[model samples]
Target: MRIVACLNGDRRPGAHPALPVSADQLAADARAVVAAGATWLHVHPRDSRGGQALEPQVVTPLLAKLRAAVPGVPISVTTGLSAEPDPWRRYDLVQRWGALPDAATVDLAEPGAVEVARLLADRQVALEARLGTVQAARILTASGLADAFAYVLIGPAEPTVAQALETVTAVEAVLDRAGVALPRLLHGREQTAWPLLDTAIAADRDIRIGLEDTLLAPDGQEAEDNAGLVSQALARIAAHA
Candidate 1:
């Protein structure tokens, strides 16, 4: 029942109505989503100019405020390529984090993913392995670093639902063959979000949903906010559970 509420992704504030950008805004939404039954939070801290960042200056204050806003729930941030593309710079940024999120995603699709992941492991920050493609999963398998992560998240990059599901199954099967038994967290982006969520539900795996996954509800209507999406996900989890 790990309902992760992703407040905002790499997208700017203008991408969605009231998308949380500032520290204050993200803190407010964190409290709101927790109240709405979200057990975990996945956040994107923004810089002064409103772009996602992993710089110590940008991430420190945000983590401080979030810890105050929602005291107990686990908070995670992205180490995805979108935040900072340069692998070495990304490594430097994460290495110097003034305050660290409880956990952080290390997407294997990006360059130097293994190196970055090893750094986070050395720092004792809990890891979430983001496998958005078959190649990423293979990389994880080849690296033999499955035990370092909190879980492996399958977020398919395929455009169609069938293709996405197929890739998810393939990735899982590959990991299974590699003796990687970490719990799986399944999600999809935009058009594939709801269907993949259902797939995760029926399979009884951990599921993530929020603006990062989609801007609309299951009925194809625009969602009010992260809380609304969490509420919807909770309802569906109940029904499927």
Candidate 2:
């Protein structure tokens, strides 16, 4: 099971304030996370004004700096539809940057998601199919485009770990039936984060944890930074291991 730390690029004060906003802060956080048992790093490049923008100019420099900071750690970038509404524009950014990370996670719920996945595959970019629901997981698995799989256990309406696990189990079964061999990364969002982490660790599943998923630690206290979150997650995994 691999633990990946996500460094949110967007730095909204009230919204996930623990996320690293600047490139230097992100590099520092990545180094700490790597030392804290995280073998993979997921990044979202922030604009100068602290907004989530995946411009080639922004991402290229950010990737270069992160690579220099955390050598050999597999890096994944988010192709979040919520980051940008227009699929064409987002596709343009993906094309222009030619800045491929180790992998890219594409949300299955997004518009034109399958098309985007096809494009990513055509470009030889590995894909992490993001499944937030049973339907979405079915759609992704059915499409047969994912090189890897991840389930986002959070939604606007809070769902229980059992519910999320049910979805994951079903998706796993579906993928098995489809003969797909993609590795899975399971995670939760907001207040349900630790519970889901517990679920994944108990099930011996790979996972991702960081400020992007939850600003609060398992103790119900706010995390000071991304490294702190990674440390807490590592502690949990260690105890389970």
Candidate 3:
């Protein structure tokens, strides 16, 4: 199982204060996470003014910088359709940025998911299909659009380890029926982060963690930065490995 780091672009510190918004900070974080045993990196580029908006002009340069920093790491960017109502407009950025990352994650819960998937496929960008439930997985499988699959397990207001494991089992069953032969990355949000990592490690699925997913380390303390979070996750994986 591989651990991927999610570099959430939100800098204001909603859930994770360690998430880096500046390009220089992101580049530095990328290096640290790579050193910490993360073979993959997922990023959401903030606007030039330092806000969460997937503007190609903003993202393209950041992607270039990240590529320079971590040459071999497979990087994936977020095309958050839920951030915008119109799917076509959301996709326009992907079309505009001719420079493609290794993969792009598309949320199946969003509107025009099929269309977005088609656009991604047309551009030859590998897809990391994301879902929060079995229904969403079925939708993506039926549409025949996803190149890879992931289940985003949203933690409860106060999450528990058992709850995290249950969610993964449910999603795994759903995918088994769907018969999708794609690499799977499993993760959880908020309080469920560490527990989900445990579950993912047990399941032998690709696991991800970073400031974007949770600010606190597994020990239930605020992470100093993305590097700290990655280091902690790497230690856990090594113990299990």
Candidate 4:
């Protein structure tokens, strides 16, 4: 199972004081996480005010810096609608990006997911479909683009561990039934983060950790940084093996 370290998401400034915001900060964190044993990296490139921004001006430099810091590591960026509500604008930004991610996530729950997936494929960027529910899985299956993706990111935003696991199972069943045999990257947010990480470890699924998922570590202490969270996760994975 490939362990991915999500350095940052659409987190606002001050959400976590140690959260990486600038290109330099993100690149440093990327290097730290990889050294801590993460083989994959997911990040939401940010703007001057630290909010998620999909514009090439914001994304290119951040991606360039990350590639420089972590050569050969697969990097992914979010194409989440929250960053750009207008589908045309989002598509345009991605098309114009000077530097591209090795892989990019297209949230199936979002509008224009199919178009985004096609654009990524055309650009030779591997696509990871972000399925948050059975409905999203069905949408991907219906689009007949299952083979266009490299992995299915089962990201359940459910607040409780039970709810999150249940959702992941349901989405998995849907994909299975549709013969979408892509490897899955399972993760959860906020309170469900560590519990789902434990689940992923037991299941040997592609998993992720960092300030993007939670500010607290598995023991419920404030995580020192992305590297610290990743180190703890790698230790748990090693013990499981």
Local accuracy by lDDT, each model: 0.90, 0.74, 0.73, 0.91
Candidate 1 stretches with Cα past 4 Å from truth are none
What's the true lDDT of residue 142 in model 3?
77
Cα RMSD for predicted model 1 = 0.9
Q: Write the per-residue lDDT of candidate 1 for residues 1-241, one digit (tens) a residue.
A: 5788888998767889868999999999999999999999998889988998999999999999999999989999999879997889999999999788899998998998999899889888899999988899999988868788888889997889999999999999999889898889999999999999988999888889899889998899998999999899889988975
lDDT of 1 at 178: 91
The residue-level lDDT of candidate 4 at 68 comes to 95
Please provide TM-scores, in order, for all candidate models, with all chains considered together.
Answer: 0.98, 0.89, 0.88, 0.98
N/CA/C clash count, model 4? 0
Model 2 CA lDDT for position 80:
83
Provide backbone clash counts, one per model: 0, 0, 0, 0
Model 2 quality (TM-score): 0.89
What is the C-alpha lDDT profile of model 2 across 165-228, one tens digit per residue?
Answer: 6766776776677766656667877776788788778977777788888878788888887788
lDDT of 1 at 209: 89
Q: lDDT of candidate 3?
A: 0.73
Q: On a 0 to 1 TM-score scale, where does candidate 3 land against the true structure?
A: 0.88
User: Which of candidates 2 and 4 reaches a greater lDDT?
Assistant: 4
